[model samples]
Target: MASASLKAPPLPFLRAIAWLRDGMYALHRRMVPGHIALLELATAGYLSQATCAAAELGIADALAEGPRQPADLAAAVGANEDALRRLMRLLISAGVFAQRRDGAYELTGMSQALCSDAPVTLRDLLLFFGADLHRKHWTHLSGSVRSGGSLWPELEGMEFFEFADKHPEAGEIFDRAMTSVSSLSNEPLQAAFDFGRFGSIVDVGGGRGSLLVDILQRHPSMRGTVFDLPRVREGLEEELRMPGLTGRLTFEPGSFFDSVPKGADAYLLKHILHDWSDEDAERILRTIRAAMESEARLLIIEMVMPQHHRPHPGKIIDLEMLIQTPGGRERTQTEFGNLLSRSGFVLTGVTATAAPDCVIEAHPAW
Candidate 1:
């Protein structure tokens, strides 16, 4: 009887309990930033998937003109309205889009970045990595760690480059991604290192020749060459026609594993050495060493792995290399110095760039 008259435990008591629980959660979130940050990191894959979907459907491009209802977006992209709305809801929560009071969705600054026509487009990277061939590699990341190498070749029955070569479309996507990413770093690299002293510079394994073009543009008196695979040369027509690059920049098609163009005062290997194991990296350096004169300099532009345990982009990219290439890993400064010594070169200096990469200057020891 007394228990039956409890009166739902008093509504205010229940409300207080709810408030206390919420306060505890808020306090935890405020106090333990790392805990909340890790929670966000755990969901990073899902966020990438959402971004991939948005990029594939050209959602940002569709909304570029203005805001649109979920129904309209679905119709424009040929998707189911409800499903699109749900996806947009997730993206909106991720700060990619904003929902109007009327239920229409509009692009945010971040979302605008996904547009294909954006000045610096990451659309190709998103689309490339989101594709089945590339995305599936991440599934075996743990196995790659256990095996001390990449599991991508094992899963695909072919190396990544082989697969890319076999699939021209995939190769195109890869090249476009490389071009887009390289474009972002080129300006920073140009600003970071002075190219004035070198009479001639060769961009080894330079994709699309963007870096060299940017370099030669800044140092008009300097001659430059883009040395890469034959396929890379084929893609450089437009780049060759650019105002400053027309007659100054030349193309040399070949493999760096075999040889590089000779007689350049400086040989620039931007983001190249990290793609190989120590043995392979040494071999590439030796080959370059043979091609270079005693006074010639090797400018190796790459992410120098930091010594401290802090949030560094190189650390994450190193993991990606581990998952993608069997022997690829970012090197520390000491590691670079030792590698150079083994390859008949001396690491003269390492200069930080405006970007995440560093310019590691080495000269032939012999």
Candidate 2:
């Protein structure tokens, strides 16, 4: 029986087969590390979608107090117990949640961001991005890329702002998201720039007065105005009620395309110019120019697009502009200089902040 088994294969033949198997195993070992990274990258969209689902279900809010079993959580949120358990497993692995030894889940620091009462809650922001309309429009991103135009008009039968105006719920979420994002940028701006030098500053297109309110609070000597369309200016009374903001910060309702309030030493265009085409941006700039004195400064607070070799948040946001706005885009230094010159201002300097955004200073061309 031992001789019969030994005769099954020649020694050289068996060695050749073993060698081939070893070579294949070696190739697999080498390829697996790279393949794992690529797989994670390729499947990243699923993670985002899952996160949106969790936010929509208010899982963070449910887990606010303590850990809970998957069944209890599913019952609380009206989700499928098994499916929610699976989702929680993935989330726990992703660092959004933590799994306990007892098979319950708890909120981690990352999941705290989705809690409704968190200082800077991003729940609404997640919901807004994962909303049906936004997701539907994103499906046409390829169309936008090919046409060099946005899918906003085609998707909603109007511009994004028009759509938001028509939908109060979406508008509220969008406004809240903007406020959350702006609040994050406000501190870096306060640290980087000296707003105390300007007697008065007008925040053109300031929505809900968050940034202006923050600025006025930071600079006791500076009085500020928050200017935007009537719809955007609505409900800002609550925002203006901050302790020292009574007489310091005020609202000015109007359109940037038409006119911005005059007589302010500095006009602030925070995250504004990136929302329109060159023609529209120039028109808005001209309106500000008409309202400004030769010595008045234009402080544009936005992300300065960097060179293409490295990664930048502005570059990703520029693609967002392409998806939502007709010709809106983040600009490089040269682009900013050109736009400022055409709009009757000189690009004086760009001050970097701890945040990715910068304070681009310009003076009216005398």
TM-score of each: 0.85, 0.86
lDDT of 1 by residue, 191-290 (tens): 5678788999889888877677767776878889899878776688877777766778889888888998888899999888998999999989998988
Which candidate number would show the highest TM-score if scored against the true structure?
2
Best by lDDT: 2
Clashing residue pairs found in predicted model 2: none
Q: Rate the local accuracy (lDDT) of all candidates.
A: 0.82, 0.83
Give the worst 10-residue stretch by lDDT in candidate 2. 1-10
Those runs of model 2 whose alpha carbons end farther than 4 Å from true positions after fitting are 1-38
RMSD of each: 13.5, 15.2
- Model 1's lDDT to the true fold? 0.82
